[model samples]
Target: MPVVLSLNVAQKTAPADHARVGATGIDKRPVDGPLRVSPPGAKGTAGSGVAGDSIADWNAHGGDYQAVYGYAREDLDWWQSELGTELGAGQFGENLTTQGIDHTNALVGEHWRIGTALLEVTGPRIPCRTFAEFLGQRGWVKRFTQAARPGAYFRVLEEGLVGPGDEITVVHRPGHDVTVELFFRAVTTEAALLPRLLAAGDSVPPEVVELVHRRSAVELDS
Candidate 1:
């Protein structure tokens, strides 16, 4: 059964490097207490859904659509081996470092019940310059994208408190086969896979749905 291996919250601090703005919360640390979570409105106006956690880049991170981040421990382990480095919980800036679930391949729109909260898998966590800088790796963004193992992002549907060791129950899964990996592939390296993302309907990002429709129209015209 899937479980929350660790619950991490960001410890906001001044820019860790020149790659970021005034401050950044990319270096999340594991927390033992229950965390309050809720919808954080939108991207620019919000910080983080997990109360006490911080978000420095209002333009790029945090919002109702990405209220939570879940990365599988298995993937982190893989990265540790591939990068030859020691990575701990929250290394990837994930709120919930999970175990026992194929989190990276989780289908978009799947609902999960962890603790007293209900969350829906919304999209794939895109690798950003901050992430690359935080990892201190060269071409890290390209490498991460190539792996196609980007962790899944979530939106809290029913707000509540959650903590580490909580069992993650997948309450529902959309019928479509739009896994996080597929979503990443469609939006990034493989443009040809975009059409298949249409099958996900509204489960994916609104911009993605609109892009698919626009592309479909262009193809029809051609």
Candidate 2:
């Protein structure tokens, strides 16, 4: 039942009100047919793993770890209700807009077989100033942080083609309960949850685990 409702790619970029001075690839549009998915190398080098998609802000946006961004259509509908606006696919700049998938509850290190490409969940999308500017909503960052439906960034495990309407199969799911929502909370508002992130093991990025250890050391010293 979990299928990709739409496959979106950034069509263009222009000046924006974000930290990235030149442009922001936040305006993504749904595309037809198969789109290639592969590792986009590093942040400064490659941008989006989805072929034809663009990433304007490389310094903090794209990399092998964040090859693709996925968001749930269900969550978008919820936001529509909250904001009283009809949101189209890729409105949140997601590469894959899926239906029937609980992205918020999806665990880190989860593997999804979508079309021919394989993707692994890496972390939650941290809302930034660009997101706020794109949405044009007051206190957007705080609201999104509190809502905790930040979506999830994915790493391409196997390069292949992906398209809209493709069924998403969960080929693997991590044993840990470190869901994306939990991870976002840990790094954002809920500092106490940081220690619990260790339960996720290497499923989450090493920097996250290192942060947990550093926090513990700081706590011990103080």
Candidate 3:
């Protein structure tokens, strides 16, 4: 019964001298189906298995789909409280701000419906230098990585327009044991949790699994 408390969009704008490029402007759009376009700055080369039309592209670049990257919403107050600031105002790198569910707990392959659009939770966001630039803090990337509460990223299985104040509901929770957070941790901190994540029996994407395996081996050797 989670609802979208608010939606926002970034308009094209110049990046701050040292500030990471946040989305240009925040606005409301319609959600009609799965696989929406990835927001600007997140697009990949053609046929990268990434739908480049909507907000998914931005997400692929380690941006949050809802709160900090595309739009800003208050529904993510918990993130602010936990991080001790306004996350949507540019703390968490989200696009669409949401409420009701803990994004970190949302697993891969899970489907969620917001308004008319359906999105499948695909993975956890990986922190990057952009995040640190946006936050104006050194070690911001490491801080987020160590926090282990990476937000969820989604792929549009159906395409549709979405806007602010829509209702976001879970349509399906895949019965997979591996979770988005675990997958993220496995890749980021391969030495610590990779084995456990593999043992969890969750369906991990091949790219992610391989990344973790390689890193894990390096850690063991060191």
- Clashes per model (N, Cα, C within 3 A): 0, 0, 49
- Comparing 2 and 3 by lDDT, which wins? 2
Residue-by-residue lDDT tens digits, candidate 1, 1-222: 889999998867557564457578888999996988899987678978998888888777888878899899999999999999999999999999999998767888899999999999988988988898888999998999999899988988999999998999999988888888988988888878998887776667676788888988999999
Q: Write the per-residue lDDT of candidate 2 for residues 1-222, one digit (tens) a residue.
A: 999999999977767757565689888999996899999996566788999998888877878878999999999999999999999999999999999989999998999999999999988999988888898898999999989998999989999999999999999988888899999999999999999888877667666788999999999999
Which stretches of model 2 miss by more than 4 angstroms? none
**Local distance difference test, candidate 1:** 0.87
Best by lDDT: 2
Residues 92-208, candidate 3: write the lDDT tens digits.
545455666777666776777766667767667777665576566678788778877776766555556565566778888876566777777767776577665554333344455
lDDT of 2: 0.89
The true-versus-predicted C-alpha distance at residue 163 of model 1, in Å, is 0.3
Q: Give lDDT: candidate 2, residue 82.
A: 96
- Assess the local accuracy of residue 8 in candidate 2 as a C-alpha lDDT between 0 and 100: 95
Task: Give the TM-score of each candidate.
Answer: 0.93, 0.94, 0.66
RMSD of 3: 5.9
Sliding window of 10 residues with minimal summed lDDT for model 3? 45-54
